[model samples]
Target: MNASSPIGIFDSGIGGLTVAHAVTRLLPNENIIYFGDTAHLPYGDKSSAAIQAYSIKICNVLLQQKCKVILIACNSASAAAYELVKEYVGSKAKVINVIDPVIDYIDHHYRGKTVGLIGTKQTVNSNIYRKKTDALGKDIVLKSLATPLLAPMIEEGFFNNNISESIIYQYLANEELSGIEALILGCTHYPLIKSQIDSFYKENITILDTSEIVAAALKKYLSQSSLLNNLNAYIRHFYVSDYTQSFERSTQIFFGEQIRLEHYPLWE
Candidate 1:
């Protein structure tokens, strides 16, 4: 639990880079080691068991890197594997998930109102948001929509263009999203299009994205635990199970810098 230890963050793919970027901005002195399971990506469509297996593999790599804390930056992975990772990591490192922070944000800010949730099929089908909201006794109506296309579309570089807009409109304009005061961008990849989604709704509804929320949560935890890094030189390492030009492109897009990404193939 030393301050110099890097924070580990992982997602199914480059989507988790959103959280990694936010963490860097909020805690500039903390080193980070991010792993993207690009080979088994789009975990949203996969079964819970499969997601857990992938998550365990990623966490093991993160632990081997000597990370002091682990952040599950993908919604689908968080939904399926947060508890498992938490249990597995135990006291060796803290485990944070993108899902709980957003849920807590909604519970505190949007209580008694209708909140819309959008994520991949596995996440929505898991009914995690509704279950968590209910467990917290938050008196809000939780409406969930399985948006299985946005991640792949964004991965293919369709973001912020006419094609992206058309797909976003088709999903957000659905009847199921009506009457909600706030919409939860359940996927980490969704923040890349946060402005588009906001514009589509004309800023009438609040869009909750996990990047800032999770970053803030991590900062608070680090501060309270006295684990804040004091060094000025921060190192960031990026790894992917499978390497591709598209992932490198998306990493730069989300991280806002051309970073050298390393390949660490987990499956043979």
Candidate 2:
């Protein structure tokens, strides 16, 4: 594995850009190759087999890109397909998902506290976070609100507006988001509304957004496995399964600047 090889990260849609941002902040000198399967924007609504098939398609693209490691940055993709990718990518490249890092963080740092989950319907249904948090012997209460509206809300850059806040309030209407000392922004897109979420809950709530944690975990694994990028070379690649002018415009919130966009016929 070349130290300079780029890391591959994929999401069902543009939300994985959150993960890409963290990787950039954590390993500024390393290259990244990101793929967004935007044709199927919300993985939360798809069945398990559909997610598995879609994940493998993006994984193949990453392999073609010669990525040194792949990050399954989307929660639904991670939940339904990380094991499949790990099995397929076996012994060659590293693959890490967003789940374990959150578990590890809660176990090691948080110790014991109830966690509030705000994610897509699929993630909450899978019970991945709830089971993992409980497995660590932490007396954590799992309260989840499937905020499906958030994906398109952030994608459309609506986080700063009152409409987005109204959506958040509507999503958590029956659930008590005010009480949890710890909140998990289970979707990559949720961090875009972190300030608004914070404003609603106040400052003392410890929000856990795993983009940083996952990036740190990937960095540690790359270092120990001797796959860290070479100090001298850096690069970034952006690929979308479907191209849109709006994508390039919205990417500034995530990617800072629009690099050229490439399209691949994935999930076809």
lDDT of each: 0.91, 0.83
lDDT of 1 by residue, 1-268 (tens): 7999999999988889999999999999999999999998889888999999999988899999889999999999988999998998899899999988887788789878999999999889989989999888768899989999999998777899999999899999899999999999999999999999999999999898789999999999999999999999999999999998767976899889998889999976
Residue 23, model 2: Cα distance from true site in angstroms:
0.5
TM accuracy, model 1: 0.98
Write the residue-wise lDDT of candidate 2 on 1-268 in tens digits: 5888889999977788888998998898898998988888889889989999888888888998888888999998888888999999886678899988888877876765677888888888888887888888867777777778898778878888889999876775555564677888899888788888788766678878878888899888888988877686688888888899888778777766666668888755
Return the clash pairs for model 1, or none: none
Whole-model lDDT, model 1? 0.91
Candidate 1: list runs displaced more than 4 Å. Answer: none
TM-scores of the models, in the order given: 0.98, 0.95
In candidate 2, which residue ranges exceed 4 Å CA deviation? 176-178
